[model samples]
Target chain A: MDNYIEIIGFIAAVLTTAAFLPQVYKTWKTKDVSALSLPMLLMFFIGVLGWLIYGVLIDSPSMIFANAITLVSSFLLVYYKIKYQK
Target chain B: MDNYIEIIGFIAAVLTTAAFLPQVYKTWKTKDVSALSLPMLLMFFIGVLGWLIYGVLIDSPSMIFANAITLVSSFLLVYYKIKYQK
Candidate 1:
């Protein structure tokens, strides 16, 4: 049961973290950030950073791993948002 | 120390979850989802649902709270993406 729970958490981490890649790729390829909100990206970046710190403090490898990857992708989105702004 | 750590987690949860609102609001008002990736939203919704289950299994209130709210906002984004597809 515990193992199953752990698996669920791990899968959850992968799904959420991996989900960002598509958006990043789409934005990178098209350079169309018209629909992306700057405030959302900015806040998400900061929020993910906080999650990273909190994960470290709690010593949760899954949170740390997921949030770290998410941080990078979120940063890319922010960069794209600025560079491709209309 | 522990209390501070918990506080950090709480704030992190609040930031990440609250971050989605602006995007939802923007997508709702503008009806433009050209830049929004459907795959990302679908994956995110499933992932957040996973997080909610994991939170329940682990009995983590913060996880449950954050993911639940994020789940709703993510759903809205998915709905908007479909409804406002360019």
Candidate 2:
């Protein structure tokens, strides 16, 4: 059961974290952030940072790994939001 | 220290989960899913589902709550992608 749960966590992390890839790809390919929301990106960045801290404190590698990727993905979006948004 | 970690997790949950709102709003408002990738959305949906199971198994409220909201938001995106994509 514990192993099952861990597997679930791993799957969840992979899916959720990877979800941002499309946006990242689109943002990268188009270099367009006009439609992306700055406030939303900012909130996500802050939130992912919090998750990273939380993962570190809990010593959960699954959480850490997932949030770490999420952080980068979201950060890129935020960066682009600033760089490309009109 | 533990409390602090929990707090961090809570904040992380709030931020990450809330991060999807803008997209949801945009999708709803614009009724456009052209830029959104179906593959990515599908992966994210699967991943969040796994996280939900993990949360249930671990008996963690923070994880459960965050993933639950994420599930809804992502699901909406997926629904819209199917509905509005060109």
Candidate 3:
């Protein structure tokens, strides 16, 4: 069913979006960024922003929602990486 | 244009997926995963896998492609984290 497929997409969106929380929490708590690549975080933030724009273009609410959350989370990681870099 | 929108999605996919390369390379060269969180890696892997499946269901090539590359990259991160952890 179409609804079922949409549900799957929603679940996938949630999974991928929520997956970043642990990293954000860990980084916030420990501020250990030695292994966290700054370039990677920057690129991911830009990329997810792109996804958000694309989602808006496509008018997919799930994609928009997922990418928005991911954008914020990746941005936090980037901020922490820069702030905590030794 | 629809084509342009699709192009944006492709670009976003490429950036998000390719973003992992730097981290992978750094980890490979340094084998320093102290900042890498195992829970994050595991959750991201599962999430990306879910995205891959949803992409298939949605018949989105870009989603499938992006998630596939990300899945492998994240898996490698997990592998390195476990293998190199001190």
Q: Residues B1-86, candidate 3: write the lDDT tens digits.
A: 98888788898999988887787888899999987778868877887887788778767777888988988888999999999998
- DockQ ranking, best first: 2, 1, 3
Error of 1 at B79 (Å): 3.2
Off by over 4 Å in 1: A82-86, B82-86
Among all windows of ten consecutive residues in candidate 3 chain A, which has the lowest summed lDDT? A1-10
Ranking by lDDT: 1, 3, 2
**On a 0 to 100 scale, what is the lDDT of residue A24 in model 2?**
88
Q: In candidate 2, what are the lDDT values of residues A1-86, reduced to their tens digit?
A: 56766677777788777777777888999998877788888898999888778777766677788989988988999988888877
Candidate 2 chain A, which ten residues in sequence have the lowest lDDT sum?
A1-10
The sequence of per-residue lDDT tens digits that candidate 1 reaches over residues A1-86 is 87887788788899998887887888899999987778878888998998889878867667788999999999999999999897
Each candidate structure's count of clashing pairs: 0, 0, 0
Native contacts matched by each model: 0.85, 1.00, 0.75
Maximum-DockQ candidate: 2
True contacts kept of 3: 0.75
lDDT of 1 by residue, B2-86 (tens): 7787777788888888787877877798898886789878988999999899878777667788998999899999988888786
Report the TM-score of candidate 1, chain B only: 0.89
